[model samples]
Target: MRQIWHVGKTVLGMLLRHPITGTSIIPLLPDGRIVLVRRRDNGLWALPGGMVDWGEDIPTTVLRELKEETGLELVQLGRLVGVYSAAERDPRVHSICVVVEAQVQGKMQVVDTLEIIEVKDFLPSELPLEELSHDHGQQLKDYLNGMTTLA
Candidate 1:
């Protein structure tokens, strides 16, 4: 029927018109510790980042997400560190990511409202990242090594 075809076209059009957008902020503590959250959904420890909204800049989304997730305000964000994507890493659609060095301007206060069950600062070695996806953990480790090399 034309009605069914029209509905299908509408759905397809929407899918083609709007792709999902996301951003992440890599907030680091003063002592070189990174801010991470324990997600309630899977109990995984990961960086402070998430999806970007419509009409939002990537960096703005990152900063906003950082503040929302860890209650940390970013004084500045530096050069792009890296990006990650893998089939097993993200259990959903493919994603294009951009990571940058960021400095926290204030103390991190974990917020429970962000669906974060817990928050803590830890050394890259002592990071509680057991449940993290494979690629994410590797990227974090790489970031740690880069930080160390800079010292």
Candidate 2:
């Protein structure tokens, strides 16, 4: 009765009040190339990343997402590139993205076929910046310019 209604309200509030947290990985290879994934939904290139799963820390999320999206293993988790919190950064939901530069190794493959269509490495000079999905263009630019951002 009253207790049940209060509990339901609390749950709903919790769900709506917090933005989902995610990690966007700039997977840097030893050859100085970066890995980017082609998104299935929009056919646009994007940084390799995904939302942080429950019970996972940020570093763990970065590693898991990099492997899942790009088939690359993290050699070292580099600096935080930025923390993007604009409500419209992700079209599917309100999410806060922690972008990191990761030194990674391993064969590049398309592991998540459902979300990604292609996985490819690009030299810094050859990145398709204008066609990147979401806010990834800005993210990559910040990383390339040797700037850490909070936006």
Candidate 3:
């Protein structure tokens, strides 16, 4: 017998239930404030990101999702913050998110309001970690711990 798993609208063989691939960015302003989006679904603040589509590489997904969610096109991509794969990181599904450090060069706007209610910037020490969605607070914690140098 084969095991089965459900992910979003698709079903996968249990053994093939590889964690979904996603990318998120800790978009920083030149002044050192980090960008975050407020999720419309649950009203929790989160880094801008989304699931990686089939046939897309992680870097492409990172850029695309950043643009889609935050309208940031001129960004300087930095080092990988870390890869988060805790089984309970997300409430919706088991997944892996590649967290990257980035610096956005432009005005911040809420482009994908359906998923993001607003965009805001905050100093790392001033982040409302308790209000972040999905394991984003932990991800940000990893960044602040000097896991990677932000650009």
Please give the CA lDDT of all the candidate structures: 0.67, 0.92, 0.82
lDDT of 1 by residue, 87-118 (tens): 24444444555666788867667665647776
6-50 per-residue lDDT for model 3 (tens digits): 443244326556888787889988899998999998998999999
Off by over 4 Å in 1: 1-19, 112-114, 147-151
lDDT of 2 at 72: 91
Q: How much is the lDDT of residue 126 in candidate 3?
A: 91
Report the C-alpha lDDT of model 2 over 30-123, residue by residue, as the tens digit.
9999999999989999998988998999999998888888889999999999999998888666789999999999999998899999999999
The segments of candidate 3 whose C-alpha lies over 4 angstroms from its true place after superposition are 1-16, 148-151
TM-scores for all candidates?
A: 0.75, 0.89, 0.85
Pairing residues by index, what is the TM-score of model 1?
Answer: 0.75
TM-score, cand. 2: 0.89
Clashing pairs in 2: none
